[model samples]
Target: MLIERPEANAGTTGREREMKDIIIVGGGYVGLSVAVAVKKAAPHLEIELMEAAPEHVWQKDERASAIIAAAINMLKTLELWDDIKDDAQPINDMIVTDSKTGEPVKPVFLTFADRAATNEPFAYMIPNVSMVRALRQKADELGITIRHGAAVTAFENNGGHAKITLAGGEEIATRLVVACDGVRSRLRYMAGIKTVKFDYGQSGIVTTVAHERPHNGRAEEHFLPAGPFAILPLKGNRSSLVWTERTDDAKRLVESDDMVFEVELERRFGHHLGKLELAGGRRAFPLGLTLSRAFIAPRLALAGDAAHGIHPISGQGLNLGFKDVAALAETIVEADRMGLDIGAMDTLERYQSWRRFDTVRMGMTTDVLNRLFSNDIGPLRVARDFGLGVVDRMPGLKRYFIEEAAGRTMHDKPKLLAGEPL
Candidate 1:
C-alpha cells in the first residue's frame, strides 16, 4: 500500500487540498490547451506545462489559425473566447478558383463558416500570436504552472505515475502526464510507442499579404496543379496565405528574393482582391501525416500534433488538438466521478478510443484533398469541381458539410467537446 502525506496547515483554518499534480510536456497549442481543459474540468488539479524554448517559437511565423466552431466553444468554456474574438476575422464565405489556362472551370462559393455563429461565421481567422497569448494568459489565471526553458530530458513511468527529470535537473512526480510535444515527441518514443506517418511530396508556405482591396471577410482558395493555394481572411485588408507547392519549388520560394517571390505570389494569387503585396515573413513546412500507433501507454497519453500530424489543406491542426483536449478532459473527469485512477491505461484508453478515429479520419481527409486537388489532370479537376458544385447546390448536404467544418457533428463528439465537460 502507498503511504499518504499529511497536509500542512498554512496559517489558516482547516481546508483540505484539492489538487493532484499533473505534469504536461511541451507548451505549444496542444500542451497548453490540454492543461486548460484539464483544469477547467477539475479546478483543483495542479497542472504544470513544460517548454524547452525560452520564448514560444510559434511567433516566428505570421500565419493565423482558422479557428473551427468547436474550438471557439472550447475557448468560451475557458473564459478566453471573449478576449481574442475581436482580433479575429470571421470567414463568412470562401471562393475556390482554378489556375488552369482556360476560362473558369471550377468555381464554388462556400458558406461553412457561418455555422460557427447562427448568422455570423463558420470560423474565425485568429493570428498565431493572439491565440498563444490568450492561452498563456489563461494558464496564469487558472494557476497552471508555466515552466519556460524547461525540458524533460528523461522520465520513468512505474505503471502508476510518471516521474520526469527536467533539463535543469529538477524532478517532478505526477499521477498523469499528457504528451503534447508535437509530432517529434521524445516522450512517446521513450514510452516505447511506435508511430505511423508518411510525408507528402509537398511543402506548405505560410505568410501574410496586404491586398489592394478589402477581402470583406471572405477567403479564397486557388487549386493549382502543384498544390492548394489558400488565402484565409485576416483583419483589415490583409490575409494569411498557405500555399502548398512542390517541395523543390517551395525550397526555391523560401530562398527567393523579395521581388522574385512577389512575382511568383502574384501568379498564384489572382487579382480578385486586387494587388497582393507580400507582408510579414515567409516560412515553409514539409507536409506529412503522423499518428501514434498506440495513443495510451501506461500512465501516459498523447495529444495534439504529438498524437497525430496532418496536411494543413483544411486548417485543422490546432482544432484537432482542442478536440483531443476536450475528449481527454471528459474522460478524466468522468473517471474522477467514478473514483477510478484517471491515469490508468484502462481509463486513458477511453480518451484514446474517443479521439484516435477522428484524428485518422481527418488526417486521411486532408491527404485525399491534397492529392485530389493538387493534380493537373483535367478529368479529375472536372470531377472534383463538379462534386463541389453538387454539394454547394444541395442544402442538406451543404448544411451537413458546414456543420462538420463548424465542428458541430453529433456523431462522435465527446461530452466536453459539446461545451459541457463531464
Candidate 2:
C-alpha cells in the first residue's frame, strides 16, 4: 500500500510519498528493462521510475541501435520482441573494410554471416523510438509507476533506506535506487562515484538515408582514418549511417548547407548503393570513454552509462547496458528470495562482481580498436588489414567470434538473456 503524506493535497510544500521497494532513476532502455525484469520476477515489490523528460519526448528520438541476439532474447522473454519485431531489420551478414574517405576502391577484408546454432541472425537494427514505445507499453501493463518530469535532485542513503528529493521539491523514500542515467549522471556524482574518462577527439555523425538500391540485410563497416563508418541495414531501401570524423570537421559538416553535407556524405558512402537521399535529420555526438569507479555505493547501484560508457566502435554500447539489466535484476530477485536486504552492500556487491569484469573487458577492447583503426599509419594499416583477411579465411575462428558477438559464450548468463523467464 502507498503511504500518502497528510499534506499531499496542499500546494504549499512538496508532496511526500510512501516508501517504495525499489526506485529506478532515468527512463532510458536500461531503466525500463530493469523495471520490467524486476516486476516479472517479483510482483510484490513496489517499483517506481523517475524520468527528467516529459512523456512525449521519447517519441521524438530518431536514432537506431544494434540489438544483439542475447538482448533480442531478453525482449522476447518480456513479450516485447513480437511487438517490435516487424519493424526490426535483421543483419544477415557483415563486411569490414579499410580505406580512406575518398578512396575509389574499398576492398572487403573481413566477412561474417549469421550461422549460430539457433539459426537466428547475430543482431537486429531497431529504431530507438519504437523500442522505447514497446517497453513503455509493457511497463504500463505490469502496473509499474512511471513519473515523467520527476527528476531526482538529491538523495541520501540512510541505514535502512534512501530519502530522495525531486527537482519539484517533492520527497520520496525507497529501499534502493538504481541509476540508469546517461554518461553524465548527476546522481552518480551526488553519490561520490568517480569515473575514468577521456575524450577521443572525434565525433560520430548519425543519420538515415534512402538509396536507390536495397541493402539486402547486409551491414558494412569502413575503417577510415578518422574512425569507423558503419552502414547498418534498415527496412526497405534505407540504411542508417554512423559516420565518424574529427570533432572540428564533424561540427562543420553538420552545420553546413544540405548540399555540402550530402556531398561530404557521398564521398565517404561511395556509389555502390546507387543514389542516396537524406531520409531524416542528422546529428553528431562527441566520442568518449567513461567508466565509473564503483558500480554500487550503500543503497544505490549504477547501471548502463552511469556505470560504464565505452567507445561505439563495435556498436555494443546498448547491448552492454542490457547485460547490466539482466545481471542486476537477477541479483536483486535472488537476494530478495533469500530474505536478505536487497539494498545492502553485500547484496549489491554480487551485481558489481558479476558485471565489472565484463564491462572492463569490452571497454578496453573498444578502446584498443578505436586507437588501432582510427589512423592512417601505413605499416599499421597494412598489418591490421592482413590480420582481418586472415580471420575471414578461418571459418572456425569466424564462428567463434560470431557466437561471442551473439552473447552465447556466457555459461553463467542470467535467465532472461538465455530466453527464459526471470
Candidate 3:
C-alpha cells in the first residue's frame, strides 16, 4: 500500500491515514542507516530525515570510529563498504597494559590476535567523514528526503500517528518517529523517555598523530591512573588517540601550547611509534554512561546515542548504535511486510527487547571497567593485572574475547548485520 503525505489541517480518521510512514529526526550515521536499511527492504514505506545542523556539517568531522566486523557486514549489505574500505584501517591485533603514566617498561598483560582463526580483521578504524559521506550518498540513491537545518521543537504522539513541529512551526505527521539526535537528544526527552546516567568525572581527548613508523595494524590500550589511553591504528603512519584524563586536566591539555601538550602526550604515548606529530585537531569530550529507561514510547523509538550512550573505554559506543540500526530496521521492515502497524507498541517492543539487554550490559561493563582501571590503588592494580595475565595465557579465552569484540559471536543478530538482505 502506498501512503501519501496529508496536507496541513488535514484530519486523519485512522492509522492508515498517516501523512508519512516514518520520520527520522537527526541525520547522523544512525539516522541515515535507519532510513537506508528500512527503505531498501521495504520500498513502499515513506521516510524523511531531518538534521538540525547546516548542510555538509558532517564533512567537517575529523574524528574516526572503530567499526566492528558485524557493522562492517551491515555496511557491505548496504553496498557502502566499497566506498568506505579504502579509508578504513583494520585491527589485526590489540594489546592491553596496566601501568603508570611514565613507566619505563609497560608490560602487556593481555594480548589478542584477532585474526588468527577468522583470517579477517576484528574491527576497522573508519573516518567519520568517510562513513557519513557514503551514507548520505546511499540515502540520496534511495530517494530518502534529507533536510538540514530543520530542527524539531515539539513532538506529540496522537493515538493514530505522531505529530512533530519543526522550528518554523511546520508540522509533519508520521506513523513512527525515530530519534537519533544524540546522547542529549531533545526528541527522547520530548517523548518522555528518562535515562540512567552517570558521569565518570573523566574526559577523552581525541586527536590524530602521525608516527615515524607504521603501526603494523596493532592497537593498544594503556590503563593509566587517570584512565585508558587508546592508540587506534589508521591508514598510513597516522593513528588516532583517545587519551582519557580528569575533566579539568583534559581541558587543560587540549588548550595547552603544542610543546607542553606533546611533552605530556609522549609521557603516556611512549616512544614505541617513535617521534609523533599532531596530525589532526584536538578536542575533549566528557565521558559518561547514559542508558534510556525505555527504547520505545507509542509511536516514538530511540536509536543510537538517544537510546544509550556508554563510556568510550571499550570503543563499543558507536558499534552499539549500529547494532540498534540493525535490530530496529529489521523490526520496522518485518512488521511492515506482515501488514502490521510498524509504529504499534507491540511491534516496537520486539526491538526494545532485542536491544535493551545488550545496551544495559555494555553500559554497566564500561562503567565498571572505567572505575576499576582508572585508578592507582596498588592492590586493585595488582588484582586486575593478575586477571589480565591469566586471560592472556589462556588461548581459548583470548579467542573468545576477540570474537566477542568483533561482534561475530553474538546470537540472534539481524539479517543485515550478518551480511544478508533484510
Candidate 4:
C-alpha cells in the first residue's frame, strides 16, 4: 500500500486532510490516460490516481496493444504521441485465412491494405510498458498526484463527494471517482453496478516472437478451428502473437516445455517468417464479454475494462478503452467550464450516453465475429469464407471496412479523438 505523501505537501496535521477534485482508481493505460487528459484540459482541478501495483511493476509489462487511428489522434491531442512514436510499429496490411489445425495448407480468404487516403496506416502496435511510461511521465509533468501500491479498499458516495479508503488506511475525499480497475473491478462492484458477462470457453495465449525474416509491416490473422491466431508486426523482425485455443489446450501449451511449446507454435505459425524464436514470456488470458449495466452512479463513473470487456478478436479492446478516456475527459472538462458539478448524475449521464451504445455495438460485433470464426462447422465455414472472399473482391467495400477499422465511422466523436483540444 502507498504509505508516503507527496514531498512538497508532506507533514500535514490530521485536521488538514487533502481533498481532490477527482481521484482515479487503477493506473493502467485507461486510468493514466484519463488522468493526464483531464489535467491537460482543466489544470486547476486537483487529480490523484491510485494503483494497486508498485511503480516498478508498470514498466515490466511486456504485453503489446494495437492503437487504432482514433486513439492515435487522441494521444496526439494529449501531446504524448511525439514521445512514443518511434516505438510504434504501423500495421501496413492485413491478411485473413481460414484452416484447420495441422492442415498442410491454409487458404487466404480476405486481405486489407491499411493505408488510408491520407497515406496513414489504420493502426499501430505499441508496447504496453512504453505507452504507460509516457503517460506517467506526462502526468508527473502536469503535477497529477499518483500513488503507486495503493488500492481503494472501499468508497462511499455521500451525496456530493466520494470518501475513499485506501488499503493502508489513508482516507481521501474527492468530488468524483473514476474506476478503471479492469474487467473484474472491485470498485464497480462496490458502487452496486452490475454487469452482463459471458465467458467464451477459450483463452488467448500472448507473447512476442522474433523471426529471421521481416513481416514488412504486415499483420496476419489465421482462423483455425479453435480460434483466431494473430501475428502483429512490432519493431525489427519481432511480432506480437495472440493465439487463441480452448482454455484447456491453451493452459497446457503455455505450461509446456520450451521445445514442446515451440513445436505447437510452429504448427500454427507458417514457416514463411523463417526461423522463429520466442522473444518474450508467454501468458494466457481467459476470453469473455463483460459490459456494465450503468456507467455512472452517484459520484462514481466507470471507464475502460471496468465499463466494458470484449473479445480481442477484433483487437479493439484497448481502442475502446481509449474511447472511454476521451469521452469522460471531455465530459468533465466541459462541465467544469460551465461551472457545474462534474460528478453530478446529470453530468455523468452525458458521458454514459455518449459511450454506452458504441461500447455495446463493438462488444456484440466482436462476440459475433468470434463465434462465426472459432468453429469447424462445415456449412457455416463455407458460407463465412464465401462472405470473406466476396468482401476481398470489392475494392470499395474493403476500403469502407478499413475506414471503420480505423475508427473513422460516423459517431459522436469526442474532441480529443478528433485531434482537438478540450
Candidate 5:
C-alpha cells in the first residue's frame, strides 16, 4: 500500500533495492546505541538513523547522567568505555538524609558504601557529550548512515515494511523502525500507542557547582519538604545537582538573579563542601512519569524515553534507557542470526515482553518514592525516616539494595549488559 520514492534508491544496491533493514529515529545515546549494536552484530543489515537536530547539536548538551555498573559493562562491550572512563566520576559513596531545607544539622538516615563489596563503584556520572561522542564515533566506524536535520513528518506500517516521510518530503522505506525519541515522541503517537502519564507538579533544577573542597566521589540525597535535593559528584571538585522544587518556585529561582539563587542554594547545599560556585548554566525540567501501553506496534519498536520516562528520584532514568538498549539490541541481533523476520510481530513481542515488566516496575517505584518523600506531613516524614533507618541497620537488606542499584541482581540480563557480545 506504500510506494518508495525513486530518489530514495539513489545510492542503493540490490540488497537495498526496496527497503533498509532498520531505521532508528532519534540521535541520542539510546538511538545511536541501537544503531551501533545491531550493525556491529549483523553487518549485513542495512541500517540508518534519522536525527531531527543538526549534526553538531548533541555536542551542546551540558547535562550528565548516572550510569550504573551494568550499563558500564554494555559500554565496554561496545568499546566505548575507554573513551568515556577518563571523564566519568565514580560514585564511591552515597548517603541519604531527611531534613528541612534550613536544618543546621541533618541526621543521615541511610548510607551506602558498596565499592568495597562489589569491587567496582556502583555507578559513574558521565557527561552527555562524552557518551554521545563515543557512540557517534562508533556508529561511523560501523558504517551506519546517520541523517541529521531530518525529522519524521509521517509514519506508516505497510504490513511488510514501514514508510517514513521526512519533513523535507523525502521518503524512507525500512523493514523495521525504532523510535528512541524523548518522552513526547511523535513516532509513538503516530503508532497510536497510548501512555499512562502523571505530572508531579514539580521541576528538577539541574546545574553544576564547583566547591572548594573535594567530594571524594560521594553523592548525597537530602529529602526536603518540596522534594529531593541530590548532589552527585563529577570529576575534580565539581558536582551536578538535581534540585527539586515546586513548579512555580523552580521557574522563579532559575530566572532569579545569581545572588538570590546561590543564597537559596547554599541554604540547602551545606558548607561541608566549603564555598560553592556555579560551574555551568542552570535549567529546570518538569518532573513526570510516562509509560507507553505497548513497546511495539506492527513493524515498529520504541526504546529509551520513547518507551518509558520515569522520575529522577532514584537517578535511574538514563540507566533505564540503557537497559532497553541492551535488551532490544540483543533481541534484534538474535532474530537476525536465526534468519527470522526481525520486524515480525513475534520478534518484537519478545523484546516488548522482556522489557515491559521492568519498565512498569521502575515507573511505579519512582512514583511511590516521589509521593512518599515530597511532602512535609510530620507523620509521613517520621514513618519514612524510620523506614530508611531500619533498612540502613539491616546489612543484608542494604546489600540487596546495592546489588539491585548496580544492576547485578537482575535475572536473565542481555549478553551486552553482562559484558558478552552476540
Candidate 6:
C-alpha cells in the first residue's frame, strides 16, 4: 500500500489533539535513550514510548554497549548516568592489532581515561540490561508514559500531527513521532521512506567471558582476514567480545556446543585473557549498514538505528545513537521554548542536519575499515599495516584517531557533548 506523506494543513492546531508531544516506537537502546533524553530536556512535554514487546528486553539483549564519554555526558545531563554508572566498565586504554600474519599492524594507546585530559573517562562498557533497567527506573520517576505491549498498528500523518492507531484499537495523536526502532523500523516503512542498505556478508558473534586474568581495563581490537575481533573490557576478570566471522561460520559457531565453541573463540581471543569461560549466552547479529534516504519529514523524524546502522569494527554504533539523542533533544527543547511546534520541519531539520552526516560518515568509515581489514590481499595488507605503524609513531595523529573514536568531536555538537549543555 502506498502511504501518503502529506505536508501540514494550514492552521493545524499543534496541541489541540489527543496526542502526546512525542510518540517513540521502539524501546531498544535508541528508543529508550531518546525518550529519556527528550523528556529530561522538556519535562512538561508529554512523551510516550511504546514498545511492542511485553516487557523490556533486558534479558534478550545481552549485547554490551560502549558508552563513550560524550554519550555518558548526555545521560548525565538527563540524570540517567548515575543510575547505571556502577554497572558500567570504564575503558582506560585500548589496543588495536593485526593478528593474521604474525606481523603487528598499527597499535596505539587510547587515553580516554581522563577524557583526553578533559577530566572525564573516554568511554564505559555497559550491558543492554543495565541501561534498560536504569532508563525504566528513571522514566517511572519522571512520569513519562512507558507503554509496553502497545504497538502502533496504523498511522496517519499530516505534518502538524500524527494520528496513530494502537494494536489494542486505541487511537492517539501526537505532534511529533520519532522512530528509534531498529534497522527494520516499521514506522520508517510506513512513512514511505526509502533506505540504502548493503550487507557486509558477515555476522557478529557476541558473548561475555569470565577469565582468570584481570583485563586491567585494556580493550583489544584484532583485525583478521575474516573480520574484526574486539575484546572490550568488562567488570573484573571478564571481557565482552564481538567476533565477526563469515556468515556460515557464524551460524556454525552459534549452533556449536560450548566446548567446540570455546576453541574457535580462543583462537581469535589470545591466551592473555586466560582460559575463557563463557559468562553469557552466545548470540549472533548480521552485520550491515543501512542509511535512510531522509531523516525528517515535518511531523516525523528518525533517530538511532532507524536512521543508520554501522559496522561494529570501531564500536561506535551505540555512541552514534546517543549522539542522535543529544541532537534531537536539544533541537526539540530549543524549538519548544520559542513556542514553535517542536515537530515543525524547520525544528526537525536541525536534528536531521545535525545527525545525518555523522551517521553516514561513520557508516562509510566502518564499512571501509571492515573491507580493508577483512581481506587477504597481500599488497593491501602491507599498505594497511604500514599505515597503522605510521599512525602509531605519530603522537598527534594517534590522539586524533583516539578522540574521534571517543565521540568527542562529532559533526553535530550537542551542548552536553561539548560540555556546555548541562
Q: Candidate 1 residues 1-422, lDDT tens each?
A: 23232233222123212224578899887788888877877886678888988875766747799987777877877777878988999888777776552233445534443444366476899987888888888888888888788888876775545677777666666678888888999999888999988988899999999999998888777778888888888999999999998899999999999999998887777676788788899999998888889888887889888898898888888888888888888887777667777777788888888888888899889889988988889888778888877777787887777778888884678765566645
lDDT of 2 by residue, 316-411 (tens): 999999999999999999888877888889999999999998998999999999999999999999999999999999998999988888898875
Pairs in clash, predicted candidate 3: none
Q: Residue 236, candidate 3: how far off, in angstroms?
A: 0.2
Q: Model 2, stretches more than 4 Å misplaced?
A: 1-15
Model 6: lowest-lDDT 10 consecutive positions: 1-10
State each model's C-alpha RMSD to the native. 4.5, 3.3, 2.6, 4.2, 3.2, 4.6
**Tens-digit lDDT track for model 3 on 197-314?**
9888999999999999999999999999999999999999999999999999999999999999999989999998899999999999998989999999999999999999999999
Candidate lDDT scores, in order, read 0.79, 0.91, 0.92, 0.91, 0.91, 0.79
TM-score of 6: 0.91
Q: What's the TM-score of every candidate structure?
A: 0.91, 0.96, 0.96, 0.96, 0.96, 0.91
- In Å, residue 41's CA in model 4 sits off its true spot by 1.2
**lDDT tens digits by residue: candidate 5, 1-422:** 22233355654444334578899999999999999988988998899999999999888888899999999999999999999999999999999999999898989999997673559998999999999999999999999999999899889988767788888677777879999989999999999999999999999999999999999999999999999999999999999999999999999999999999999999999999999999999999999999999999998999999999988999999998999999999999888877777888898999999999999999999999999999999999999999999999999999889988988887789999899997
Instruction: Candidate 3: list runs displaced more than 4 Å.
Output: 1-18
User: Which of the two candidates, 1 or 3, achieves a greater TM-score against the reference?
Assistant: 3
Once model 5 is optimally superposed onto the true structure by TM-score, how far is the C-alpha of residue 392 displaced, in angstroms? Answer: 0.7
- Name the regions of candidate 1 deviating beyond 4 angstroms: 1-20, 56-61, 101-117
Residue pairs clashing in model 4 are: none
